[model samples]
Target: MKSPIRIILLILGFIMLLSEGFMGLPFLGGTYILSLGWAPLGSNITMYFVMFLITILDRSNESRSSLSTIAAVDIFANMIAFIPFVGMFLHWLMFFLMLVYIGIVLNTREYRGNTTHYDRHRAGETVREYK
Candidate 1:
């Protein structure tokens, strides 16, 4: 992805992380926010948008990031977020998981530093002769 776009996404992810983490607390009325109301639906849609944006904007051939995978799981959790106590705990857990995933996503590089021997062979380059 372009550097500017990547930075934008990283920023957006952090914002979402903060919003969910703080608002998810019971004292802050997180339960109500994640309840059977429209919040979960909005979050689910945001998750889908983020997943698709990352997958599409990211031109790298590497496999999808853990965030995408966790987002998939979050969908299920959101479904059950209608539950009373369980939903609150799940939201907190999801925040922690998102923290780890965002770290991984931020640290990942778009390109490998060097090509492997297999790449040389595939390109029909001469290999060093062995005795």
Candidate 2:
């Protein structure tokens, strides 16, 4: 993924993390919207489903693939959520979570070489090369 996209994903992740905390606050409109019956349940179900999708995506690649797949999934899911009855809020939330997941995947460290080390002093400065 490009650096700019990764940075944007990180920013979105931070926003989602914040929103996740306030999801229960009555002052935040979602709480009221959630109280109106089926929407809340539907939103919860959608969130879990999307989370599962993200997990599957994560497991499919050992390294960050590209921004294309992530962007496609996000945009497609958001479009599906736009249906008036289904509401796009939950889909947006999942999109944000996926952004976070992608950011995490991008930031993870990958070992490029052997990490084990042996002390030269203990071996009296003898130099040995292992192939």
Candidate 3:
């Protein structure tokens, strides 16, 4: 994946992390959304659908196979996120997992060989010989 796209995903992950905290606030105040209705479950399912779409898109970028795998796992994690305690822990775990995945993506280079003339010169190769 491109650097800009990876950065955008990192930003989105942070936003989701923040939203996760906010979602817990009601629970602390004794206002359970789960008790109110099935809205929370419905929203979680909707989010899973959206994440599935993202996973499909990520899969199209052949260079980032690991990213697609991580995204796919994230979809399943979110699917079970409506469960009382397990769901909450999974959400937090997935957020951190995503951060790690983004770090890996950012650190990876698409082309490992040196492309600059200076690098070739330092390697004792004639710069003019490069195509």
Candidate 4:
């Protein structure tokens, strides 16, 4: 991926992680705002938009699965937000899911593989020799 694209993805991921804090605040806060009925739907819509952008920026197949998982959770939470009693609970559940997704992305082996391959090449083993 291009450097600019990667930077944008990193920024967006940070924003999504930060947004989780809203879930903890008082009324007019995460859950309270969500309880306001339609407003939560709007917030969730914004989240879905951001999530979609992130998904598009992800190039690696392994990373795509985690991004899609996060998108699915966001969509599900938004849909459930239309409910009266269970919306807040679903919101919290989605928040935790996002946390897990972030952790998975950070600890993924994709970056490690690249570094390991570079090290092997640097150690003077030619591609033909490996084969």
Which candidate number would show the highest TM-score if scored against the true structure? 1
Pairwise TM-score winner, candidates 1 and 2: 1
lDDT of 3 by residue, 6-37 (tens): 56655655655554554445354124546755
Which model, 1 or 2, shows the larger lDDT? 1
Tens-digit lDDT track of model 4 for 4-82: 5445555656665556446434344555664575775676668767766766666753567666767777776776655
All predictions: root-mean-square deviation over Cα? Answer: 6.3, 10.7, 6.7, 6.4
Consecutive 10-residue window with the lowest summed lDDT within model 2? 59-68
> Across residues 52-123, which tens digit of lDDT does each residue of candidate 2 receive?
344345433344444334544544444454344344454456546555565665765543345678777565
Q: Against the hidden true structure, what lDDT does model 2 obtain?
A: 0.48
Displacement of residue 116 (Cα, Å) in model 2 is 19
When 3 and 4 are scored with TM-score, the better candidate is: 4
Clashing pairs in 3: none
Compare candidates 2 and 3 on lDDT and give the better one.
3
Shift of residue 33 alpha carbon in model 2, Å: 11
Candidate 3 runs further than 4 Å off: 21-26, 29-63, 110-131
lDDT per model, in order? 0.62, 0.48, 0.56, 0.61
Clashing pairs in 2: none
- Tens digit of per-residue lDDT, candidate 1, span 27-71: 554545635465754665476467545755566625455556766
- Please list all clashing residue pairs in model 1, or write none if there are none: none
